[model samples]
Target: MSNNLFKDLVSSVEQAGVEVNHEALQVAKDKLAMKSIIIRVISILGSLLGLGLFIGFIALAASDIFQEAIAFILMGVLFLGGAFALNRSNDGAITVSIAVSLYIIGYAFLSYGLSNDGHLMGYSMFVIALITLFLYNNHIISFLSSLSILVAIHFIMFDLDIQTFYYIYLAIVLAATTYLFWQEQRLRTMDNLIGHRYLPIFAALFTYTLVTGIISSTQQFGYYYFSEFRGVRLFFITVLVAALLFTVHLVLDKMKVSKLPIQIATYLLVIIFNVLVAYYYPAFGIACLFILWGFMRQFKAGFAVGIATLVWAMGMFYYDLGVSLLAKSISLMIVGAMFLAIYYLIQKKGEKHDNI
Candidate 1:
């Protein structure tokens, strides 16, 4: 269908007196569609290896100059400059691979230089990532830098033993996740630096969101460090549920769900029900958010993830209860049936929409 759509688009343009070299376009597409995922993974591993080697070399330098904070900062800046220059060279994979290594190593030096101060280290890394977004435009580097920003934020909160602003951080993540996916096309088509970096940022945001969701569910770092703010968990659930609802609204609008009065009534009912469900099982709501995105974008991976997350969260929820096995079995059956019914309705709606 997508191939057909592309051909139809080219045909329409040709009819409008536009010249399109489809043979050349097909060649380019074929080249781009090569199996690059494994290559990318290897490239990333190579960069990490390079970073490790650089650290080891720096440690064994055995020079007082190497021990100074300014020395590390200078080295980081130098490496970052090299990376930026390499990126601008229109080089092939080898050059970009080397640039990625240098970029990681550069940030490592910066981190070590500011190791004495947590706030300085985290904020400086964030600033460096921001600068890199404008200077280096490669996919791997952009993704790594976006991840660096998230690492910086968490490092500040966790390293400094301050969990007060966890809710604020959560809010930022949710808001960014919603906005990035919602405005994806606009950002991708932009005629500036942002367009080049949007996909990387979008991917990074989802990676961050899913990782944090796991951490939250597992009662791990977020739980250990921020347990004192247990009350704020409710705030998290509220905010997340709101995000889910807002996203649903956007999706329903696109689906042309119903007339205004009917849509408003449906929204009210959903809110009422979700409020109760979220209070007891917030992870379920989180999973539903992913499911919504999965459906909206025809994203099979995200949809699978959402379903897996849903099963895991519900299993946990049931595990936590002290109810009898019979009660649990019944409960699972009920929810499972409800989900199937909803899925059936959605499938019917999709078929109808397609026919229309």
Candidate 2:
């Protein structure tokens, strides 16, 4: 009886172990099946979205009916498709191809729209390009979109009075594009591309400002024949300032002397020069101050100098109101002292933290 009981106990233990193993295996299989189903579903959905976007993009390029509406639709599809593709694939070639295709389609639609006369298609194209640029993560697409938008703007305002609104618009666009190109070049360490990208943009802005200045002087100020010449002179001065500042920046960057002390010294020197020049030759002083401030690196001293220069410029050029130079001097001294106090406080706090 004892032997029979022990054998039954052993059999029961073996059966229980087998059951647990079977259950675990079944659970793992179920999980795997579930995962496979999910993957298949996602793949199908992605493919379908991609197909739909391709069709929409083609339709926009082919049809001219309500171009802006078509553009919006195309943009929506591309955005969805791009998101899906990026999530689904780690393939660089695929991502680049999709980006290029979307960009080309966007460009085609924009070009067609802008080519049509008497249509606010130019503005529409600009909006579309901006949307495409924002939606797509591809660098190529972003560059192309920016270029297309710029071209569309030029075409739209070809015959219009550029001085009325285009000047500000051009300045903003040029600045933004220049910054973008700068960032890209910095990231890639591509000096050649940087030069190519920024030079034309700078030239365009300089030319526009110069031409507008001339036209405004002649047409509005009744300078008549010399308005054009005056515009040329203004343009040359603007160019000179820009070139000088840019050269200074290049030298500083090459020297790698971007430390706080050097920067502060630069600001001090610039401020002193501007003040002395203003005392001697007040006409060019304000412009010099503005150029210097705009080019200087933004630090504590730089900010102070910028504000002081701006106040002096406004006083000299915009307002004929005379102020007590002593009062101005006192105010600036107080500001400088306050800044020093703050800096000392920050330094003390840092030291205390370091000690702890």
Candidate 3:
């Protein structure tokens, strides 16, 4: 009986060894496949770049026969056509890069030819973006295309009053994006497979929101167009938007945890804290909302982007504050300490959760 048991144990160990070896072999194969794919992608990018540069040089040399803008537009058309053909052939990386390059060239030509008026460019890019979204469903292409459309619209409407037209446009974008974000979350809660597909779109919109919000708030990038309230009203509107975003987050939190009493108490605390932050450090408040949204949605890119923007906003705030350098330094130190404490708390909580 003892001999039989020993033989069975040895057999089991041998079987486990085989399985482990199989897994390791599979992992190696996967790594090799990934390496090949990366090599191919790099080759494609280099080829495309070389081709683009050659065409650009030819265009420059032939500038007498064809105007610079016309030459660029022609090159853009050729690239766009090539992108469509490559996409049809299922070459994603190169296809998307070509599309992006085409957009860059087209935008440059349009900017130069149209005397900086962006209405035509904006509409053209938006149409192209929609077509690409439907045709390829590529995430990076969609993001850049959407970003171009938004920027073009901004340039097109640069002369509008900030209080009325700009604020209304922003609110519409905010409301639509929030609805899309929540709807995706809701579908995910219901375990719908399609819900995962649109998450990228929402993530892109979050990026767009962060970028446009920051630019408007800081008056960066030569954004001098404003209404009667000018800077004051723009800041107020931003704070209001932040409050609204926080409110949406609160609702999402309640949906997740469903603890009414805790939610109410938390809300009260947030209201008090938010008012002070909104008044004194409005950009920081908006950044916090972005961070919250990113974490809640499990969007790592958004989280990283929010952290970057938060740092920028903080630095800008410190620079612009009308206070003594010593006081400013002290305030920064206090904020740094608070961040450390928060980081420590988060680490502890994560460790506890992991143990559980």
Report the Cα lDDT for residue 84, model 2. Answer: 39
lDDT of 2 by residue, 194-283 (tens): 333333343333334333333332323323223233343344334433433453455356445567775555545444533433332222
TM-score of 1: 0.75
Candidate ranking under lDDT, highest first, comes to 1, 3, 2
* Model 3 ranges with Cα > 4 A deviation: 1-48, 68-73, 92-120, 127-132, 159-164, 185-200, 219-226, 230-265, 272-282, 322-356
Q: Work out the TM-score per prediction.
A: 0.75, 0.34, 0.63
Pairwise lDDT winner, candidates 1 and 2: 1
Candidate 1, 343: how far from true, in Å? 2.0
Alpha carbon deviation, residue 107, candidate 2 (Å): 4.1
Compare candidates 1 and 3 on TM-score and give the better one.
Answer: 1
Q: After superposition, how far is residue 84 of candidate 3 from its true place, in Å?
A: 0.9
For model 2 the local lDDT of residue 325 reads 65
Decreasing TM-score order of the candidates: 1, 3, 2
Best by TM-score: 1
- Local lDDT at 270 for model 3: 47
Over the stretch 1-356, how does candidate 3's per-residue lDDT look in tens digits?
23245447657978787433433443354355455656545655776587678766976787674554555456556655655565455534555555545544544444444433444665555565555555544444555555666665665565342333565565555666767765653554353323423544655666666666676656354145344545554555555555554654564453453556745544544454445333344455556566656666565666677688778866875776554687556556544653553364357557768999
